[model samples]
Target: MIDDKTTPCPFLGEMVVMFCQAYPVRKPVPKHLITASNPCAGKGYKGCPFFKDIMAGLGGATGVDPTLASRDRKGVTS
Candidate 1:
């Protein structure tokens, strides 16, 4: 299996960008709707933009989720 942290990082970055571009409104995506499954298993935590912002808010790297900085601290999977 891929390290959980590394697996989701790229998807999270893309989500961050998508979320920022579509920000100012909250769009709730049902867990089933998301499709980044191979690496993330469609877990909102893996591909959900909200999580990216949350990770960023916790004094992490400005854009990408910091847990992705390595194969550690992947934290909770959606």
Candidate 2:
């Protein structure tokens, strides 16, 4: 259940939590968002609060910049 408080994905135009549903499994992160292959790689689970929290921690879908989020995974920043 998405609410106004939910952040919309800047790329997909859907709620960040809904990203798991729309994307299902992880795919190659878009080049505009990331500069590496499989930068945002991960398996997605429906109705998983952990996934939601991760997305939120990454600044929600709307606020997230894949490049920046990838830093958390790779321990690198640009």
Candidate 3:
């Protein structure tokens, strides 16, 4: 779940919390967000909350990218 390594994700805290709740078995760390091998190893996940949470829980077991489950809204395009 490593982000791009450019900047820290604003949603990192929320994402980690959600991830822990969703997948109590595999508690991911902030390091995962920068490892490139984790499931949600990208950016823009900071926006899509649900998808991001799901991916964190899945932990690469699912090929689902949180960014793709995005829904369009006014001023919001992914």
Best by TM-score: 2
Model 2: pairs clashing at backbone N, Cα or C within 3 Å: none
After superposition, the stretches of candidate 3 with alpha carbons farther than 4 Å from their true spots are 1-46, 60-62, 65-78
Model 1 lDDT tens row, 1-78: 688765666645322222222234544445454457533343445465755655565565556644454223343222
Candidate 1: lDDT of 10?
60
lDDT of each: 0.45, 0.47, 0.47
Per-residue C-alpha lDDT of model 2 across residues 3-75, encoded as one tens digit per residue: 7568766686532221222234544443455323332343333245645666776667866654456456543
Task: Provide the lowest-lDDT 10-residue window in model 3.
Answer: 15-24
Per-residue lDDT for 1-78 in model 3, tens only? 666888778776544322323332545465535555444554643445555565655564466644453322233343
**Candidate 3 steric clashes:** 5
Off by over 4 Å in 2: 1-44, 62-71, 74-78
Clashes of each: 0, 0, 5
TM-score of 1: 0.23
Q: Give the TM-score of candidate 3.
A: 0.20
- Candidate 1: list runs displaced more than 4 Å: 1-44, 61-78
